[model samples]
Target: MARNKNRTEVKNYKKKKLTVSTSEESPAKKKKMSPKDPEDPDDALSKVESPEMKDLEDLTPEEQRKRERKLKKERKKEEKRLKRESAIDDDDEEEKPSKPSVCELSLQYLKSWSEKRKDWKFQKTRQIWLLQNMYDQEKISDDYFPILLEYLEGLKGSARDTTVKQAEDLMKEYDKSEAKAEADVQKMSRIREVLQLLS
Candidate 1:
């Protein structure tokens, strides 16, 4: 049997590994390393006024308010974006045309129907009122309420009083709801009482 040269093992002449012990650094290696001072005013200031420092004193009053407003708006937009993204078509639920609440749907129906029955100027006026109503949701101004009330009063001869009364009552209810909401908020807050007194 021939011994294969490729399979032959070489003699290992390597020294066995040893764990050498180390002592304190030599004078050459121990070049002067300074210790930090306990009471440097500049260092103290630098620590306090670092890039990540929460120094409201450095920021302008307007800048502070603007940052807060921006943060609030971003939070609101994120909430709205999440709500819109999560909208699901629930098939099991009744498919009766889903609307933006009864109040909003009624306002839209009235606006469109009134536009068709009446004219452009009236539609424009109604649209402005509708926009304000959507924003406020709680308050109906005296200007709009009286205009609507008068219109309803005049329509008594043409349309049923019951129908006109319902529209009039909706406006009245909106005003009453706003008043109640204000009262409720006042009752809930001691801060509001202080602010009211200051004003």
Candidate 2:
């Protein structure tokens, strides 16, 4: 008899606990599942229909024409705004001068002169111009001066007297500079060798 009473008490306790847990959960679930209010008419209309298309069939001819004109004006304004933005972007890009490639610089130099010269003359002139420009801009190191001179020497042709003279002058200048540099280097090395011997 005592065991039966204890079993009944345990079962009652479990039932009471379940009811308390369910009660606690009900309010939270109710908050989450609450009914939403009806959507605003303006929001619904904006989403599903544009002002231009709304009630078009019911409107008179004059009203329709006015709507059409308003749409056209808005379209023109949008187009103008886009064009203005594009112009500003182009101006920004132009303000920043990009580094020119050798071929591009050559073309620019050729375009600058009005008189037309022979092909070989033009090519030699272009090469000299490129070397000078690159040297001035510090784009080409002094070590490459000999290589550029050799390249110019290789372009020599009997086609134009003036071009050949110019190339020879440039070559002579480069050779003199290179010789001076070599002599300086040798003098420095000899001084270093003597210092080592003394040490």
lDDT of each: 0.39, 0.48
Tens digits of per-residue lDDT for model 1, 49-101: 53312332344566445444643464566558667666543444547677676
Each prediction's RMSD over C-alphas, in Å, is 25.2, 24.5
Candidate 1 TM-score, true structure as reference: 0.20
Candidate 1 Cα RMSD (Å): 25.2
Q: Identify the candidate with maximal TM-score.
A: 2
**lDDT of model 1 at position 196:** 31
Q: Going through the candidates in order, what is the number of backbone clashes in each?
A: 0, 0
Minimum summed lDDT over a 10-residue window in model 2 is located at 27-36
